[model samples]
Target: DTAFPAVHWVMMGLNPTGSFTPADEAYTMGFEGREAKKEGDMRLLKERAKELGPGGIAKLYMDKLSGTFADGAGGYHSELSLSRDYGILWKYVYGTHRDYILLLTQLFYLASLFMSLYIVINFIKKDISPEAFVIMLFVLGSFFFQMIWEAGTIYSIGIYPYVFALCVLGLNAKKEGEARKEENDDVRKPGFRYGNKSGFFISAAGFIALIAVHLRYPRESVIVSVDQFLFQANDPIALSDGMEIKQSFVSDKDFSIISLKARNFEGQFNDSVYEVSLKDGNGDLIKTNEIYGKDMTDYEFTTMDFENVPGVTDYEISIKKISGENDLIFLYYDTGHTDVYPKGKMTGITGSDTADLTFEVYDKEEPGE
Candidate 1:
């Protein structure tokens, strides 16, 4: 069975010939390279792989499988490991708002755990059906694989059916147990029975409470925007002459603010002047602002606001070091070929033509509209 699946995966290019680390590297390189030359970290990884012999490659593979590679933070599959912390997974699945939703999700996760334990206990007592036992095995196997190897929310999709099956089996077992208890005792339990007055009032009260809370606190409306920061921070573009980075964007609606991620290296204070200018489609300057290096924070978005800018579609933002002796300010960018913002293209970075600066464009929103 393993051999057949292994052969199939290899044929489909799902499984590569090298160890897991190299396989990840190959996949990233192929996916993000996009006909561009592999430079920087990608080139370094390829060289490092060639230097590693068979024994070294095997050790790396074993380390990743055992979840000991960089304390489970080294591989691409380490997303689930990192998200194991409290509220991290919830925030990833759901947006930052809606604390009530996070609490409900946590309750469901707890219920699933109890369901698993119930299935295991019934199986041990030889009271569960064969189908349920198989479903339990599949669920447990998926969990074990996540614990040992790579795990992500995406990987959990494959075992959703088994999980739903286990839930049904657990519910059926609970009802059957209740039925047997009633028959043996020859008496009916009185608490929270369906089709009863007490149950109907309690359920209605709960539903009304939920509705009240929802009406009192509605979810925040999220602004629709184009974000082109896909990959991790690449080599920062140093502020220098002839290195003026410009990002052009088009928006269907009116926009007043454009934010760019930047880093300040000069210890909280510097005497450098960073000029940010907004240019029109025909190379006409509309608005410009000068930001002192002392005011900028490290690895944070610097927002440049345009005043009295009406519904313009095509606009360009330029950032250059007007007065700075040393490289005090650096702009971050994405070297990968995301092409997420097709209406935008970044220019003025050395050694790369297709690279785009990490940026986000926000549409103007009116207050109390």
Candidate 2:
């Protein structure tokens, strides 16, 4: 009776609570800055589209041309485009939505299974053998052809599952003699045969081919950097005077905040007490606060939150290695922090350094998802 907010928000906000179509998602994928967000978006779209029934998706895609999605951390990155960046997006989409789709596909598959079992039970009463039916069940449960395609995200992770389920149902209906086909093991039926044109295997193969063709895009060849870390900044944030956190890329309609990262704290040898300030080249203090730690000598990268206020110019970082490393000063501000929800709570504050930091202005959005 209880549903977690995570799934609820995903269904409501990102997926439009299943209202939007796959065509909309596939089209929206062309937006800038959508490389990461679009994965979750498309997953919701596909599942809903399937529920609505046939050709809705194909018709949607058929009506549109390839455009751009949201602006990424590095700017425009095509969706499902064969480009390197697009590949990263694909990997994410494949991994994230794979399980949900499989469960859905399994649901459909079970429907056919139940029907076949009914037919099989009647055939047995009529003195027909049920060995082939047993064998078919075994094959379906095994890690065979359909399942094999499920492993590598063969077209959106859900692709193989959906088509596979359809194939099973289609082939089952096409089974040569549903009235009494189970009578002989020596000569099975054409529709249920492994290689028959209308059989599940052949049907699945053709479906897979179509999926492959649909997924194909002109791949983009570009250099991938090896300097990626778990979390990072993708925007050159503009900090206001005394504004520790700014709303550069705010996703939440009601929540506004950004996660802060220390550029050098993780790799540094000396752990010390320091204060960071957001300012400009004029040495004026935009936002100034000292970072107090328990293990002054423990050098580790830590992330916290600061509100982004507009009109801020730059930032300043000052530190004292260890509990007493003769106060040292360091400074760095870069671009990025895609995900919503800020990290850490407010520790201490100064004049105008209220616990709740707010941005003075909101950035205007250009047309696109």
Candidate 3:
């Protein structure tokens, strides 16, 4: 390395007949006069060596040499950017301002309870009996909301089927004046009215119970088969890119059997391998397996078995691999919605603290099917 000559303007001789030079000692001693400044500086550094610990001086010099520094830049204007979309930003800024969010949350809760009361009122007025609604409400109050944590979407869509089914059950008795009183007069006899009330009431109760179970212990059962999936083009409520499966069931037992035969598949997978896994909340290595293999060129198939697995809260499959793209298919199990639910305050902060019904297999048959 090239050395630069010291270019001090003052000389040691100019200061006094002393061992230290005036220019070198200028900033070395605060108020005390410098004495053998260069040698004294080295001695002072060595004196504090014991307090500084080994390598402390070396690290300090290294830091100075590298020009590295600790910056406090992360404290402000460093929050994670969620999205660049203006609407999303606007929503974040004002849509759920603290007060409004609290109000909405409260209203949603109030509505849930009010709707239940309304359901009960109409049920009694219609002179119907409990079928599934009993089980449904029990499950809802027990654990579905707090456990599953599926809000808004489930209520918006899930309540539809239950209401529609209940309405069908409710209106089945409402009849028009018959063209011929003798032929169309189907006034259920007073004695037979007991049976009609018994059936509809029992059904309504059962419906409530089914929804409650769906919310409480969603993963307990899965509908592996359906009679016929409602098509979006036909059923306006079923509108979505997702296909709906009609027949579904839940399990009361853990590690329950789930089997599905691949019905149909059509896709051109370029390079990737389809992957599937059962993941728990913490995302520890739970259970994973390759979904489809190369030999499945004709009609690809996939199956995974889990043993001694505790209750699961969520599950999904992904066509993922470093290679490129892939695809696979399932039978009536496709497009199944969430049934596992999270319930109560601080649900996410707690674990397996949710409540659910001990019964299973809520819906076994569809009327008129």
Candidate 4:
């Protein structure tokens, strides 16, 4: 998983020298000034060596060889014209600035991934109710603010869906708690109207609960699947470029029966495959199987009997296009929109997490079909 390496990088930032340098005398004493330096130099070397374990030393050498730093020689740096003044120079003005940037970005993504995984686990563990699941949908829907993070081009953007899903769970859970409190209170009671003190107090409580859950359990959960499809002239969200379309579902119940259906809008491609996978948060596959698409009729549901799956988070299903330049694939929407949604021209659904529903695929017919 990208997160393991990312997590290792967090330590790298705390002690940049440790990742690529050894804490041992052999490695530390070999530095440029150590041969003739004072005993104090030896002390400093020992301290640095202690901080930069063998892993750090090897990593530092690796980065140095790759030319991650301009002051450093060899490898990727040798190919570049370091003499020029540009973004690269600014990036390298400080020795370990890039590593710091990398560390921050990675930490942010790691946090999001962790949060998303937790929410997913809650769903799988039946820790959340259906109402809370709907709330998760709204939270993820609001997290489209990816445009703000590194212009929405960074790796964190990939993690936003997971974070957004969890946010939905948190926010919805809060809203429901408030609504229930309001219902119990008399309509004539003080501060019962919208935006009143009573509502505010309840809302605050819900928000606090959300935060508490986040902090109390900062552990990992399976990231069943995250799939994004932007409608391009040629590449629609469902139309694959000879790739696979995967989605994740979290189930709280262990069911012996699980099924999948993909809506295809053309002749049988004879090489389509439907796959179901059960995985952990780290993406280690637990169980997986494939169903051929050619066997099923177009626009029909094909059921597959998966083994009794353990109640867990991050169950994934994928459909592969073996050969078709432009095959009609299914697209799903959590909620319906008119103006914003492609409708008949294309099917546009709310791009958010709805844990209660099973993932489905369908073809677009008319503008809103």
TM-score of each: 0.56, 0.23, 0.21, 0.26
Which candidate gets the maximum TM-score versus the true structure?
A: 1
Give a tens-digit lDDT track for model 1, residues 28-132. Answer: 444343333233334444454566656665554444333321121122232332221124344334333434453444445445556766877888888998899
Model 3 Cα displacement at 249 (Å)? 12
Pairs in clash, predicted candidate 1: none
Model 2, stretches more than 4 Å misplaced?
A: 1-271, 281-283, 293-305, 313-369
Error of 2 at 50 (Å): 46
Q: Per-candidate RMSD vs. true structure? A: 10.8, 19.3, 32.0, 25.8
The candidate that wins on lDDT is 1
lDDT of each structure? 0.56, 0.34, 0.32, 0.41
Worst 10 residues of 3 by lDDT: 231-240
lDDT of 4: 0.41
Per-residue error for 236 in candidate 2, Å, reads: 22
Q: How many clashing residue pairs appear in each of the predictions shown?
A: 0, 35, 39, 24
Q: Could you tell me which 10 consecutive residues in candidate 2 have the lowest summed lDDT?
A: 65-74
Model 3 CA deviation exceeding 4 Å by range:
1-252, 256-272, 293-301, 311-369
lDDT of each residue in 1-369, candidate 2, tens digit only: 021223322233222222323244334444455444455545654575566445653333322111110111111112232221223444333322233333335444555555555545645666333454554455444323222111112223333343345445445544645434576565765556445445555546755665575356322222221101222222222222233432222221211222233323222453445454543334454455555433222223343234344554333222222243333212122222221113211222222221222211112222231
